[model samples]
Target: MREVFQQELREVQDRLVEIAELVAISIDKATRAFNESDVSLAEEVIAEDPRIDQATVALDELAITILARQQPVARDLRIVVSALRISASLERMGDLSTHISQLARYRFPDKVVPKSLRSTFAEMGALDVEIANKLTSLLRSEDVQLAEEIRNEDDKVDALHLSVFDKVLGEKWKGEAVDTVDATLASRYHERFADHAVAIAKMVQYLATGDWDQSAA
Candidate 1:
């Protein structure tokens, strides 16, 4: 029975890592769609979001089953609880990717980001994908240092988000109202995606150290 319970725990971890990978792909494709103004690619990203969501839901149910059947105690209990939280964070990250893709799709033919801000959005997208990949590593390895690194990457995303605002609101800004709205929403989605990655890393850190830090999330 003990071995079986342990196997279930391992399965949960594996599923979480799988979910992270899907989110990474979603963001990567979404970024490409946005950059190229490729409506088809954006549609693909949007269409696949349901897979991430369904996987997260299934993982949550499995975790809940383990909690009930195994009645996990101490560290085991922590693992189950944290798995649930991490799954939720991963799902939210996937949703953010979908949101970014939606912006690209909505603009169709024309670019969602104005030419002046394309480079900035491109950089933000790259950072988002980098942070997501790091998140997958952190989940699999549970390395606290990697968690810290993910947080640092999130800080870069935050800085980029602020820069977008500065550019849009600057006196030299010439974009139409739709352009301003699209840039703001797209930057926000990328920033929030990083935020979810950081949150998952914090959950992993708490699982490893048994020290929960709300501020980090």
Candidate 2:
């Protein structure tokens, strides 16, 4: 029974890595679509988002089953509980990517942001993609160092997010109402995407080190 329980735990980890990989791909494609105004790619992301949702649902069910059957305690209990929270965060990340792609689709033919803020949005998108990739690695390897790196990248995304607001609200701003709205919404989605990645990284770090404060970095 103990061996079977351990196998279930490994399956939970594998499922998480699989979902993380899907999230990475989603963000990569979503960011590309947002940057280049590729409506087809945007639509592709929107369509595939259901798959990510289904995966998370399945993972949650699995975690619940393990909890009920094995009645895990101590570290085993933490692993199961963390898996549930991590899967929820991953699901939200996928939704944020879809939101980014939706913005691209909404403004098809024209870029989402005006020329003035294009570079800023582009940088935020790139950082989000990088963070998603790093999050996948962190989950698969349980490397606490990767968690710290994710936190640093998330800080960059947060800074970029604030800068977007500052530019839109500045007196020099010239964009129309639609542009302002899109820029704000897009920046928010990008920032929140990184936030979810950081949350997952912290959970992974906690699993590895068993110290929430140490993982809080």
Candidate 3:
């Protein structure tokens, strides 16, 4: 029975990694769609979000089953609890990516980001992808170092988000209301996606160290 329970734990970890990979792909494609105004790619990202949602739901059910059947204690309990939290975070991250793609689709042939902020959006997208890829690695390896690196990448995303606001509000800003709204919304989605990644990484770090620091960097 103990061995079987251990196997279940491993399975949960594997599922989390799978979700991470899918989210990475979603963000990558969504970013491209936003940058290039590729409605097809945007639609693809939107359509695939249901898969990520299903995976999270399934993983949560499995974790609850283990908790009821095995009544995991100590580190085992921590693992199950953390799995639930991380799964939730990953699901939100997927939704954020979908939101970004939706913005692209809304604007259609015209780019969501204006020419003035194209470079900033591009950098944000690239960093979002980088942080997502790091999350996959962190899930697979459970390396605390990788978790910290993910947080650092998130900081960069946050900085870029602030920059977007600065440009939009600057006196030199000449974008239409719709353009400003789209830029604000899209930048927020990207920033939130990175924030979710950081949240997941912190949970992983907690699982490894057994040190639950709510103030984790």
Model 3, 1-217: lDDT tens digits are 8999999999999999999999999999999999999999999999999999999999999999999999989999989988998889889999999999999999997888789999999999999999999999999999999998988888999999999999999998999999899999999999999988988888899988877879633
Question: Whole-model Cα lDDT per candidate?
Answer: 0.92, 0.93, 0.93
Clashes per model (N, Cα, C within 3 A): 0, 0, 0
- lDDT string for model 2 (195-216, tens) is 8898889888888987785443
Candidate 1: list runs displaced more than 4 Å. Answer: none
Q: Which scores greater on lDDT, model 1 or model 2?
A: 2
**Cα lDDT of model 1 by residue, 41-159, tens digit:** 99999999999999999999999999989999989998898898888888999889999999988899999988889999999999999998998898889989999998898898899
Q: Cα miss at 50, model 3 (Å)?
A: 0.5
Clashing pairs in 1: none
Q: TM-score of model 1 relative to the true fold? A: 0.97
lDDT of 1: 0.92
